[model samples]
Target chain A: MAANQEEVKLLGVVGSPFVCRVRIALKFKGIEYEFLEENLANKSDLLLKYNPVHKKVPVFVHNEKPIAESLVIVEYIDETWNNNPILPSDPYQKALARFWSKFIDDKVVGAAWKSAFTVDEKERGKNVQEALEGLQFLEDEIKEKKFFGGEEIGLVDIAGVFIAFWIPIVQEIAGLQLFSSEKFPNLYKWSQELINHSVVKEVLPPREPLFAFFKGRYESLIASQ
Target chain B: MAANQEEVKLLGVVGSPFVCRVRIALKFKGIEYEFLEENLANKSDLLLKYNPVHKKVPVFVHNEKPIAESLVIVEYIDETWNNNPILPSDPYQKALARFWSKFIDDKVVGAAWKSAFTVDEKERGKNVQEALEGLQFLEDEIKEKKFFGGEEIGLVDIAGVFIAFWIPIVQEIAGLQLFSSEKFPNLYKWSQELINHSVVKEVLPPREPLFAFFKGRYESLIASQ
Candidate 1:
């Protein structure tokens, strides 16, 4: 690392898969950065000041310039570091990559996770079924490719960090099984490949602690109901 | 246009600001393509085949490849064409452009429009207040720049096509004058400039029909409550 390299800083919360995406991207590019853990319960002034609009982590600040939105931040990392490109160079292929990434964020993580956390028992079942249907779409998408990027863990793979790591914890907490080998073999295999990747392995939180945290939340949610 | 150029097509609905984003992008790049109007009431097989996941409009097809999501499609168009760039070339600037574009889409259009369309009178006031706060943030962002892209109408401007053209009609339909010149002077001025731009003017549906269409819907909404 050169002394003149722009100082890169990441403000993030633990167990946030969005933050993990940035961490993986930074490691893949082998860029050094200072990581500031933000207590989302009581957000720090730095986090508030930098990302006032969303006021959420992870906010990636490079040389004092703040960029919010995890996917947008990952693209910034790819653009800044020339080696080991994450997005495709071709216009059409790049569009495809971005399309999938947005699908994962919008449908898979956003909609699926909300459905998994539903308080009503009957609605929970219905929501979970819909979420799985969405996952099935992704499973079909990755049928032949080694990764969503085809040969490497690229934008789509990074966007799916939650599915690879956090979904199991969510499933355990909610006492539901969403991913099955027979039902979504490709997605299951892809999750294993993603979690085992050296860069990903370093950023993922330990499962036991994550399980305990979410378990308490789920219990409280059920009790409140 | 070259005879050998891939057959480009857009799947869209009339009065959809999202579909308008794609239309403006195509015209800006001088790309010739067929526009297939999808009866959203009864969607076509082509729309379902190309964008089964979202089952929504503004799907851009180049050759045989289909791309969904308006911002993604706009970026694709910018990348494919070498001239009249929509996104900034520099990585940091490009990231900034994307950030604002997403902000407008997610916060401004998403929240503001929902508030403006609120049925209950009391909740409508509260929602409108929150929506105005979001618009205030955007107003501050564009305080110095002629457009969010600084000098040119770029990706952010394209992403905010709704605010430029659709919102005034929404105001008329909902009977809510949210974009007061005194409150959001900069944004008001920008909206005028954007609507009057040659490329934007070419695609904007005439105001009278748009108003009549939204008025009928608003009447049904109010009557239902």
Candidate 2:
């Protein structure tokens, strides 16, 4: 397929940490692509057909071939574009990047966020403690580094975009104070840098609306209890 | 660091499916490494130090730098030793391999296996049904291909190693019959090929002992109910 003729498209939902990873990657690599907003309530046929397994966004379609999972899509973009590499050149360093990215996605974000959202107060407190410990681990990892991938904003930073933007909003809505500057100074500093970065700033959803959206969900969760 | 002088080591347990992944990948690459068996009951300081976050095996250490997570370690091995390439050279193809590999690790192995281990009979049946559906999805994906990554036993094959060896033993011990040749012929064929492969065969725990080991665990799980 010809380079110019090949169409690139991203199917994603706004305010999703996963979707933001791909969008930031695309912009950083200076790739031009169409962005299709997916209504997750009633998912689009394209989204379902493209990603039959997870059926989640952001799904990156290049030359009509679909690739799901945010980290996978980001890696694909890095490989295809070549310029402004998100992953390190050395194999070992790249492996380290992938390891931390998976950590942030699976443990820090997946487990911690789920815990913060739990309705039961006692269970929520225990999970929140565990989640804070996870964040502390990350804080130690990112100590004195400009970004998770070092000097430049790379794959690990993109993977942790949730910590920069989404989590604070979630904390507010859930009335939970899990990640605070006092406890996790390094991570708090990193989050500020991440949100302030030019590329990240472009894709981040406005804070007030995001807060309002999650507030409703949090209230519903607590009301059921 | 001199290539010959560099030390390669794997921290693993005999019957762990995750450990098998790194072992097979190392064997495929013809890399010689010392294997350290971990007693999960009292985890060694070495395993704990290497994988502080998860503290789970297998941890792949090269030149004393530890890399945890099976898929990450496999990718690191593939990149470091380029002789027998597991991941496809093409970026797009590589992405597809990663997507499916993550699916097998996260969905097929993680969720389905947990369901198979459920103590409640009714819940186990529901989970087993869901697991079968997941396997059918894989069976369809594999279609007529000799392996997941085509002719070669690539990353996807390594990731799905659990389905080939561990699941059968788990089914037997749990007194469940989730995967069968009649239901998932392709995966069944793939499993046979996987276990019989010279490199894989070397690392596989003897079936009888594996069965006994899991039977004890399954009995305990049921007894707790």
Candidate 3:
């Protein structure tokens, strides 16, 4: 059963994949949450007080206790809820899930940021190549699995929410091509399936609006450059 | 209650803080394992097979199943051994533990690397200041606690093995100082206590040899530059 909104609250900015991943976890566990929109330009005192170190968004506050860091929040959710488990049960499998998720965070998302977000043309080219190499690793890892977790969305699958949803949107506007069916069929299919997953699709921001925001942001960067 | 050497093996090189932390975790849980040395310059096929993704060391193999990543290995040890509980039981506290360790990895250790390892003199100064600022956060966080885990060495304390042992050695040889008794008194005290902890002390490489290794490595970088 879902908890009431008053007991469970989430503070985050819209369009953030970190926040998106957290929401997916909440919904997966049938946990009801009150989403408090945060303005990144002017960070709220609550956000700062809860997460003094990073001062970033996606703070999940349950009964006034805040949990920061998306992955940490997700793990906390799994640990606390203890239903529809997001991470594997076995020690070794759980370790692999953690390992692959870290790889995604450290390698794939990192390279994707440089490739599509940076204003430097040279850096874009370099990171484009880097992102492609990283995608190859994912392609091989995912293989023919429906998801990284095999027929379910779990830590690695949700950790890769960015690659599943954001990359294509950003790459198109930034005039880049990195992930595609031709290069990585299995990985691409899994990504497509992930975004379209019922739980994931419900919480995802409207595609067109999200795309427009990035489009404008990308153009603004280029215009300013 | 510990697994035997044939059933449990660790592949790594000496002087890697990642490997050192895993050793601390194993000792905490009383896991018996054989150590397999790897020549990083020419990585062994066994290491390659175990950790093809990162190709880094500290691969903990239990029952022929390999687990990569230092923190992941530590978690696996805690989960499998089910003794000397390294992480906090509460979900919120666990999240905080994860967050702080990441802060150590992303902020303090990152800055320390640039400060002491980089050839660029200007970069070193900037990163030296950065590292000191990071240490200030740690000092504040540690305030009056015996360990980050409080009353016992846990995930955060073990994760900070690099700061406790490696930083002092590297900074001295590299002609830099970011963490010390004067600047971060509380954190420095914790570091000293952690390094001297019986379990950690037994596994640590000798100071003289470790110092000499970094000194040679640092001088080589400067000589090449």
Candidate 4:
């Protein structure tokens, strides 16, 4: 690859777990990429043009080609440069891993993230309960299997790290407990294990920073009412 | 590839768009597998064990290595066999395609489908609006490309097909208009093109049967309360 063509750039905001997903994937693969922090409040012209549809951050640009959506970007990185493969070789096991990953991608952050803004106690409780149900499903389904795919950290593990790392912080920020360590022992243990992973550990923001940002954001969202 | 290791079998309920995703993938790849119809109300033990987690149908057992989740199964089929590839060779294009697929898979089905069941007109309207927004996004993003990845029916096309084929029937069943052909001419036209594909047409259920079944089920759901 030519020098200019070899560049891999990521446009994202700080304190975004979605952006973290792409960051982790790139780090794990040992791929060098320039990171540009976008102030989501005032997105760049390039960001708008590259991703006009959703216009969200964490856009991975590889050799000038832009790929929006974190998981999609991660998959693109994995496919383009095959270093540390995040997916398994066996087709069956790979499918099982993708299944759980998609489940997490679709449900945990997708729905559970909404619990922060709910005003009604009953409605909030329902949302929290639904989120817990998804967590329980993970706990029950991921017994004995080391990382939701059997003894290896793959795409599912990457998707789930959001819940394992960010959810507790989110819970702290929102003053809610969706995953009780006792109720979801397996999930709790898994979270701890994931936190210990070197790649995950390396990329994680300091707790104080994440907590401060999230707590302030939550407070603002509530106070705006 | 041994005969005695239990032939590849798919346990699925008829008329499930999720199941259809797996079916089209299998047929597209020209892979011969046994199709077992599962009665969801009284699910068989095999189906339960095959998909012990979700306990849902559309379980693909390849040499008894059971894999659940429709998109996962489709990807597995595409990877395991190599007759007709579904995803594109270009990594960027593939990522773009998967992003759209995941977007449609997670958003369109959840928000729009849930909207079909709500009692309040306001909530239902939100659902309709969300569905239309998703379709419009597809129209705008899918730039003059024959398929989502440029040409041929890829994963994005597959993802769209699930709702694409059933939305019209669902509208008729729910006595509402969520997917107006006028609003999403490109998507509507794409849906027609998808079903008309020889491979897709072969695997898809007859429109009337699926229409009747899904319509009846939704009606029953609304009537129960």
Q: Please, what are the lDDT tens digits per residue for candidate 2 over residues B11-118? A: 999888999999999889888889999999999999999999999999999988999999999999999888889999999999999998998877678656776578
Better of 1 and 4 by lDDT: 1
How high is each candidate's TM-score?
Answer: 0.95, 0.96, 0.97, 0.89
Ranking by lDDT: 3, 2, 1, 4
The parts of candidate 3 lying over 4 Å away from their true place are: none
Q: Estimate candidate 1's alpha-carbon lDDT, on a 0 to 1 scale.
A: 0.87
Model 2, span A1-225: residue lDDT tens = 224666999999887899999999988988888999999999999999999888889999998999999999999999988888999999889999999999887777865677658877788777787778779889999999989988879999999998878888888777678788998899999999999999999989888888888888878887887
**DockQ of predictions, in order shown:** 0.87, 0.90, 0.88, 0.72
Give me the candidate number with maximum lDDT: 3
Candidate topping TM-score: 3
Ranking by TM-score: 3, 2, 1, 4
- Candidate 1 is graded, for docking, as high
Per-residue alpha-carbon lDDT of candidate 3 for residues B5-99, written as tens digits (9 for 90 to 100)? 44989999888999998989988888888999999999999999998988989999999999998888888888888778998888788888888
- The 0-to-1 C-alpha lDDT of every candidate, in the order given, reads 0.87, 0.88, 0.89, 0.79
DockQ preference between candidates 2 and 3, better one: 2
Report the lDDT tens digits of candidate 1 across residue range B60-118: 99998999999999999998886788999998899989998888887678666776677
Worst 10 residues of 2 chain B by lDDT: B1-10
